[model samples]
Target: MEILAFIYFDPMYFVYVGPALLIAALAQWKVKSAYAHGNKYNASSGLTGAQTAQRILDAYGIGNVSIEAAKTFLGDHYDPKHKVLRLSPEVYQGRTLSSVGIAAHEVGHAIQDFKVYAPLAIRNGLVPMASIGTQFSFALIFAGIILSSWMDMPGARYIAVVGLGLFGATVVFQLINLPVEFNASSRAREILQQQGIVTAAEDKIVGKVLNAAAMTYVAATLTAILTMLYYASIVFGRRD
Candidate 1:
């Protein structure tokens, strides 16, 4: 099966996904660079990332969500299911602009949850299907390809089509995720400034960090789109 992946290996796949891959790499580099640079300057508020999150939630009158230190580096995320905002060690403990920016971004999700953001609700609903698609879509695709191309099996193309459809869930998830992330960052910036967590000058630095982080999501969404198109061509363009 490992060899089977290579059997269908089309250079065109790379051609289709190459720009997105480059963008993804660049976005990651930008995130690391921006984070390192922003981490050097402390926010004027003198609040740790955890504190920043708490303050933002307090301002919004959202008391139910709890903030906690996360175990991994750069693993900050909001667990909507548990109403917990988990921050990485750096974000949770540091008082830098990077820390506050990231902390507030997670808090944005909590706010979204409080407001019942429609996109967020829809995205949560798609999570299970996207997970399943990410795990098994390629295997099914390869199996279908081998059956149709090598064994000339009947109805093999249908299997590939089904795999393609499943993989679409991931693309849909990525598309839906873009607005959620952008909205969170927008909310983060606005509330951060309005609450005096970041001075106007410092807000620019926070914007840099948050914008870099948002680019990563954009890259992922682009990658998912290109990957879907690449496989669609393969499955549907097979010689009859």
Candidate 2:
């Protein structure tokens, strides 16, 4: 209780929290603005998201991947497990810049799969562990903290170390995610430009949309890294 109270009142806690919230808000604003601008400009190709995805796959000479419609908004994603690209209803049916850009981005992942992009491969391997780690990491950390305070035992310290290890996995996943996402967007922009799917004039808008979307991932990764660092500081600082 005393340790928890001390940590809670520590000015460093708020120091970290404040910046994280500010960054998160800015990221949200950027994402909303990007979506609005992208939606405002309809694609000249008149190609639905599914169509665009198929065209991209075909352009890359990828035959085995399937494109399908999903139920959620902004739900568009490529699933390597099923070899399917799923787009949200709006994206799947709409012929807007946002639709094509998003579809192409997902298809970009398919291209990565074909080429066996190393980062994507690493991310895929981390998914299961990261998922479990995310759910249990905090519980483990808190338990470790409480047990250490109560018993003053080394086992408690070990448990906390395990918690940190799990959380570290999540941090690594987020970091690797940045490169995979950026590479996918790069592929999307190049293919869109090369195929003349979007014109030179429209390229600016698409670029902004992709760039804005990439910022969200960057922000997420930054937030995760900061959070892990904050926890690590708390755990280690106390020991010294």
Give one digit per residue, the lDDT tens place, for model 2 in 96-190. 88888988899999999999999999999999999988998888877887777667775786677788899989989999999999999999988
TM-score of each: 0.96, 0.93
RMSD of candidate 2 to true structure, Å:
1.9
Model 1 residue 132 distance off true place after TM-score fit, in angstroms = 0.8
State, as a TM-score between 0 and 1, how close model 2 is to the true structure.
0.93
lDDT per model vs. reference: 0.92, 0.84
Q: Over 4 Å off in model 1, which ranges?
A: 1-9
* Model 2 regions lying over 4 Å from their true place: 4-11
List, residue by residue over 1-240, the lDDT tens digit for candidate 1.
Answer: 433564657577789999999999999999999999999999999999999999999999998998889999999999999999999999999999999999999999999999999999999999999999999898888788778777878579778788888999999999999999999999999999999889999999999999999999999999999998988887877433
Q: RMSD, each candidate, Å? A: 2.0, 1.9
Query: Which 10-residue window in model 1 sums to the lowest lDDT?
Result: 1-10
